[model samples]
Target: MTQSATWDYIRGSDKDGYAIAIATNNTVYESREVDPATALGLTFRHAFSLSDNLLLRSSLSAVHDQTWSRRSDALIWRERLDYDIGPLRLFTSVDTKVTTLNERNIFALGSFLPYPESFVTLSVLPGVLYRLSFGEIGVSLTASRTMFRFETDYLGLRRNNDRVQPNLFASATFWGIKVEGSLSYARVTFPAGDFDNLQRLLYTAKATIPLELFRLPIEKLTLELSSGRTLEDTTLPFSVINVSTLSDARLVAKFNPSHALTVFARRKDDEYVGLGARAVTTSLGAEYAYTFDGGLTAIVAGSWRYTQETGNIPVSSLNLQLGLSKRIDFSRTTTADASRATPAAPTTTR
Candidate 1:
């Protein structure tokens, strides 16, 4: 899954040149009849700086598909605010969202199928935020309560949990480069033995150089490099603690060499860096997009992923897909993937 920290600072600005369109495809090759599908989307956004101290934003989107169409059409909405009171100002947001599907009908990175019967999760998190900054120092805090539900994949019973937790973060920016990270501690008490508790801890670090920071017209062309790891309750039998590390390398560059073509590329590499003799599995992927002046767009992309077992047995999946799209601009576009844009603006999604 894509992380939520990427677009926290992008408050929209008003202008005429703010329309966008996108399309995507997924094809899995495993010597079997895997379902294939494509997605198309569009977006428009404008920003108001509100005197450099207060900001407000909103966006809406809809998603429909022929692949796993049974899942449901996705609808998403969001809003955010940032007001500078002095050294610190309070921030807040409201959001509505639904899961979209990948090739195997799965919604995230860890699996390839929908959650089994009786296994479910649904909730909305409204949060309050505080920011602190001075010279080279910066810090932020968000307290949110999640009203969530869960169930077993094999059983037919549902369970729910209501909890509040604080998300703490600290960062520093220097020499046109900024380093940031955050920590979260969650406690879920279920009364029932098997439904009881778990802990998830994560750490992330990112470094980027904005082309504009160095005075370039391409605002989307930024050099970004980052990595993160997670520790969680172990489900492995006889293991003391369960830890998995995913290291990523990503580069997002936007090229508008002329008004006729909008060129972009996204490359990512991640692997299971679990601790063991043969635990270094990896996957690498890249997508190249070309958007014509007439609003027709095409894409060609591919990926390869390999896994090595404890005994060093290796298995892999190789894939390639091509897609075509025609945006009516009149048809409503789903906002699910629009998270690729700031929550305040609709853009391409995961």
Candidate 2:
């Protein structure tokens, strides 16, 4: 069994804002397949308006996880500055991330995989956004560098590598559809020499469309599609290039034929490719919810998934769930109530 709890607080004024959040989770396992674990996380954020047209924001977060006899920790910090002109907005951000794993046992299929040692990454991003009639368009570029160090008694040696990545992204929305695209290039330098440098290129695109079917039983539908391709060129010692591609599509529909019941359906398909292997998966799910008096509701849901892979047999799975829930509103304040509760500022006649 697993249990978790989270709490958050926020304070804001005209020129400055602050927030803090913390979460703690514990998990217990009765079987031998898994080990008990406990984790805690804390985060803080602050924003300040440097001037009428300039704003600064920063955030810091840390997480600690303990499982069995092993422990892991991760920390991250980010800062951003935004400057706004009449019709254009410009922003820049910096991020630092660090992770350490102390001989942690990562279990997969009842087996232990290699435990990661530690890694640190630093990133800088600069972007510009322009408002349009239909929606908004934005372009951003990010440059990141990472150093990964791995050491284990099993390997009997320490290994270190460095990677640099630069990415460009653009996004826009028009005609009730949102589209985004990105291109990334990466170079990995091995401790051996420059001749062992690895180069990689990645391109990705995503789109979301929302529609209303007036004549059908469905009230609303949303469709999402995404695709990506990656190419990797190995070092001179290997002299090999590999290409991989991935595509995903999803659709969700909601229908309300009667006042007491609502129906929803979702479908998704995903396809992937690798050097010598390819796989495709499709999933279909449906749910029916019935509303009762006293804010009580009942839901029944089912899902089916099918997957096929090269040089492997196809697999299928089915799942079903039934649930009952009740709604509780602790705060009875409405917009009018809030407005009435706040005292208006005093005014003086000139």
- Estimated TM-score for each candidate: 0.53, 0.59
- Each model's total of backbone clashes: 7, 0
lDDT of 1 at 167: 58
Q: How far out, in Å, is residue 296 in model 1?
A: 7.8
Candidate 1 worst ten-residue window by lDDT: 1-10
Write down the lDDT that model 1 would get: 0.44
Clashing residue pairs for model 1: 12-47, 13-47, 61-335, 62-334, 62-335, 63-334, 337-349
Per-model lDDT: 0.44, 0.60
Model 2, global lDDT: 0.60
- Worst lDDT 10-window in candidate 2: 232-241
Q: What is the lDDT, from 0 to 100, of the residue 191 in candidate 1? A: 40
